[model samples]
Target: MQPSSSPSKFDNMPGDIERRPSVEEALDHEPLEKGWWYKPHVLKLNFLMLAPFVTMAAWGFDISMTNSLQSLEAFNERFDHPSGARLGFYGASTQLGGAFTIFVAPFIIQKLGRRAMCLIGSSIIIGMSIMQTFALNFNMFVAAKLLLGFGSTGVQIAAPVLITELAHPRQRERITAMYNTTIYVGLIAGAWIAFGTQDIPGDRSWQIPTILQVVLPAYQVLTIFLCPESPRWLVAKGQEEKARKILVKYHGGGQETPLVRAEMEAIMAGIEADATRIRFNKTDISALLSHKGNLHRILIATVVAVGSQCTGSGLISAYLPQILDNVGMTSTREKTLINGIINIWTWIIGLGAGYVIPKLSKRSLFLFSTSGMILTFVVWTALSAVYTQQGGYSYGIGVVAMMFIYNAFYGMCWLPLVVAYPLELATTKQRGILFSWMFFCLSMSTFAVNYINPIGLENIGWRYYIITIVFTLLILCLIYFFFVETKGLSLEEVATVFDGRENYDAAVSAVHAVEVKQAGEPEEQHVERKDER
Candidate 1:
């Protein structure tokens, strides 16, 4: 929240034509909120929110993995056989690549800004797609997968911030949902494309689907150049004036300009006020860890992220076709098609749930999702045991039903909530850093899950489901005690909630006041960009 003294000074202050700091200044004083989503420029930026799905499509790349595994086998014949260690890297590279991006994104955002960083990532994706098409050996394949993972990480971290920056509070959930929805769309698309290309004879089959992956990122690169840089970031660097012009361009006409300007000025006053109170330094682990509240928020974020990955979702996804094959599926193509159908419906329902979450208590929704996971795991464990006991077509059919049901429930709950929770918790100043680190932990968890699955299934018999079920129950306990409701709250309000310094109502009101103040202000006229400053 803005310091008490700062708001009092601005409460009755005169609007000056020349004294206002840039957009960055105001945002630095206040925080980005729901109201900002209403501006035209901000709204237009939502189109690029589709980028996450593009990254997520890589997850569904496994739709054709059976074919790829065959291709891997064929490629290995002329060369050395890829070890489990090496093969593990291929599976884990996507998340490992994500970790690399998480570690680097904060610094990159600090240097190039979010817009430039997103564009660079998009370029890497397009380049990686081309490279993957030509990879001949396991090492080259690993390099291609790593590059693709890094590119996806850029999208994963940047998309939500972009949407949060560009959207109004009323539209935030919907806009964010668009990003989440597109990812599922990407998954479905990857499944169908890879599925369709499965029988084209030789390595040429994989090339088509791999090359098709470049289309979305290439479009994102083009779009980023046309879109405005984030107004929040602009405000942070003292580019108040530029930020204002963009706001005006987005708002159009003068109808809302004065109100927007007033909010901007108030925001600037608050930021300038806060700047006077604190030291300026690059955001880092030390800064975040030094504060107890921030530490709590980080712990919550890490657990949520890790939990999302640990629910056995990645394991189910990686081995879907193989699972189907085990369950007596007739053909790979048929299985991929059925899998795509399940995924599409699952996401459609999941997106629906995410849309409603903002209206419901975040805590309640978190509990509900956690409960669904617990139930899903219980069922999964029972089904695994049943299949072990019976071992026939009946058990295989039961396995199919269990798989479909798990994906359906999972997509509706865990998928969106995991991403939504972290985005809703962190402060604007710490968001990029927090989300990146969250993704880092998520990637690490993914690496562990994917690496352990082959070994676990081969060595443990039927113990994997039992182990995962236990984690789901533990996560449910975490949600009940530590997680707070963030629905309808602005980012700054979320910051307050995490800090535990104020009552829920008061903290939310404080954040709302700050956001409304920022939204209603006009952009400052002569502020410097980060580079210029």
Candidate 2:
């Protein structure tokens, strides 16, 4: 509501298009909205937002468990001591499976909706995980995990997009950024279980740890039924009444408050405005390439996706046992313990970064992370060179410290924003397409480095850090020039960063303007408007 002494700051502007306080800002100033976040409906909204943690944790658990398994003597003996190319295939199998089905995820999300995609993905993971846990042969085990990757890609595509499109406007940024932190939770759990089970007899040591991986995905399948579909997705499918009801129940405390109306109005306006520009259920690949603003988004998505895996993580994350061996450490138990500790460290860093992300721009976050990595790699490379030539124990210790420092920077930016950045930058229809491309690209990059990391580490030793240092510099340059500021803006407001202000839909703030007109007068609270689509 406007104060009596002053006109809106936009009063002198030339166009009839209006600008108003964001609904989030207005809600903060409203006396009626005190303790708003603690309300029961908003709590329920947060629970729905938290439901995807199981899906994220599942990925973390798999990566950590697989990493620990490589160091286990029983598992190696059970599988006939897989080494060289066979071991590389063991790590690359899931990624290879992702390459097969990643592009199809967007099509399913576009047709059946994001909720449907989550359900289907969880169900597939559940089946494949059971197969993985009970497989009688190594070939059967690899086949089961390969199919599991096929399913994980679907949830990976939908979960972040759900948080992006459905969270309450004020909670969206932090929640979406924190969304990936759940993966670290999974990683920590996996590490603890594998370390604890190290002394168990025979195959149970590994099998028991693998069985726990299935539990999180099964939990997601059950909880997803209790949550509402994305209001934006609902609106795109001509289900405006359903979208409004869901928003009123959750975002408005079961009433059409000004905040709720403002958000709904913005969603309707954005969709209606983009209707001519996008076909809601159709594939957006061609549409995205044809549009200048969207194409720029795709380029950033590629940089983020490819840069995330390519930036020296491959050697540390999956091959830490080998790295430790090169540094003259040789206890299997010690290696397992170190694996657990590193993940705990990563989880702590992930939470800290997620909490702070809302206060800074996305561009600021990525630039800081990439720059830190560049410096870490340069020092790390020099340390490795010294340890290899001079054979000093102190040089080896310094190299290990540098690995932890490098991942701290990686977790600060890449772990959280890998998906969050692209989803926020996308238009409604572009969400699914952007996620598919990002994950597909991520899979391909991970696959490349999975093979390259072991061979490079064995052949050239520490010189592999040189390649990482150079590639990461290019990533930092792209982020500084391309990533835009989107600290507190709603999804519609974000379009202005890519598309110029005049080119964005002016209808976004029109309903808020109408509310400003009736601010002081006693009138109905509901700002009723049709869905226009």
Candidate 3:
């Protein structure tokens, strides 16, 4: 069979012709059991789906290094005891590079497939890690950090989209939650590595951790080729047979089963519906913006992306030691120990939440998380205020406890939802672009928080907690009002929720009509074989 270049076989059909196979007709197939999740092919598919998150962990390793490096004597000796402002710049540079990638990724993702983009991202990360490891000057180090940010953007944008496309519809949430949860594994690894090397007398203390950053990306580059291309991407690229083969292999037990056929039809229908509203061309930004529900999705994506960063996570993660110093923890060893422990706690809680995510609603999770954060910040701010005035060890301890509590809630809710929610909200045709925009929002928020945080800590002290408390409360209200539930829908079905019920029904009908027209001879022959029916 030839690869199709057009969006769909129905392209030559007239604009006024609205015929389609019925939704019922398309859905008429043997009932497939949910136990497909236990099959060997499905298990292998899950592993392949999750492989990219190692890169996410690598990204976390970079972020978590800042906390330990701040207090390490060997690191200070090499970098000349940089000021808080300069260190903040080092952290912000990565985010700045990430923000820059947002504009360029849409084009790259469109031209190259998701797998290729992931490989490119991994290669960039590997090269930057090598550069960062051997940097003789501060500027060289910062330049390497900036490049890591740029490379990470590709990983962040492509990874989730690949998972969404490849995951079983019933299991997407759990799989995505797993992806989000593993990012903390990198953070925990980085923190412990820094803590382990803190007592060393030479540059190797810091250099070793920096060198270790290459491992996960190296693994990604070596193993990513083992995974299949996203079936949705293949179909969108007009390689339906290839897409069908993938679906059968991974999802249909290596045959064109009814379940596989149904899924392909659904994906095709969604693509056709999307193409009708928006040209599939990369230059057609207007088509995306002009769609009825896309703007709302954009708003939700931006708010979720920004809200995840703005909740004071940047301040705490990047400058835990400084925050601890403010709270009377004067020992460097003590501060590093606490930072490592907190990351471990985050990883633990995040892993548990991954299992629980499928059982809870997205809005409920966000509401609970944001609400818990507000309460934690309120108490933490009050405790900090008391500590600032009276200087009690108890108040300082309370502040630290609140930090752990805040991170627990954050890991449980925000971390997993941030990537998964935005992926679900976007149509297949616009998934990459939407993710790019989401990451742009994430990078901007991270940059603002990282750059402003050190200065804020210096100037306002605990009063900065008040800003997060207020913003988090506002985010809670936004979640209650606007965020839609998308717990169990397949990727193609998700489009219907946004496009309105009537339009969805129409789109399904149009898809069915096209399928009937294309299969006219075979369908008629099958019907004749059925005789009495």
Index of the highest-lDDT prediction: 3
**1-533: candidate 3 lDDT, tens digit per residue:** 01122455554543333332222233244344666556787888877765675767888898988667778888888989877688788878888888988767776776778888888888998999899889998889999989899998889899888887887655677878778777788888989898899887898999999999988888888888798888888887889889989988987768766566667767776776665333346645655666668878898999999998998788778888779988999797888888888888888988888888988888888889888888988999999999999998999999889999999989898888889888988777779988999999999899888888887888889898888888888888888898998776667666667776553444555655566667663443322112111
Estimate the TM-score for candidate 2. 0.90
RMSDs, each prediction?
7.7, 6.4, 4.8
Clashing pairs for predicted structure model 2, backbone only: none
Stretches > 4 Å off in candidate 1: 1-45, 48-86, 251-254, 257-284, 500-533
lDDT rank order: 3, 2, 1
What is the number of backbone collisions in each predicted candidate, taken in the order shown? 26, 0, 3
Every candidate's lDDT:
0.62, 0.77, 0.79
TM-score, cand. 1? 0.80
List the candidate 3 regions with Cα displacement exceeding 4 Å.
1-8, 11-37, 276-283, 513-533
- Candidate 1 minimal-lDDT segment of 10 residues: 270-279
Q: What is the per-residue lDDT of model 1 for residues 1-533, given as tens digits with 9 covering 90 to 100?
A: 32122233234332332333233343454434546555445555454444433444444453234234433323445336553455556667777777788767776765567777778887887897788778877677778878777877877787667666655444566556445555566677766666666666766566677787777777777777566666666766768777767656654323344335544543343333331121235443445466666677778888888887787676666655445554566565557677667667777877787777667786786677667766866776666666667767776677667767777667765777767778777655566777888888988898887677656665654577788888888888887888877776555445556554333223223433454455574435334334312
Q: List runs of model 2 lying over 4 Å from the truth.
A: 1-21, 30-36, 276-287, 509-533
Question: Across residues 1-533, which tens digit of lDDT does each residue of candidate 2 receive?
Answer: 00011223323333343443355655564454567577888788888766665578898888887788888888988988776677777887777788766657877888888878888888888898888788888898889878888888888888778778888777787888888878888888888898898899998899888888888888888888677889998987779789989989998878977677667767765654453333334453454456677778779889989998899887777888888888877788878887788888877898888888988877888888899999998999998898889898888788789989998999998988887888888777667877888888988888888767777778888998798889889889998888888787778767667765542445454434444564553334433333311
Give the winner by lDDT: 1 or 3.
3
State every prediction's TM-score relative to the real structure.
0.80, 0.90, 0.90
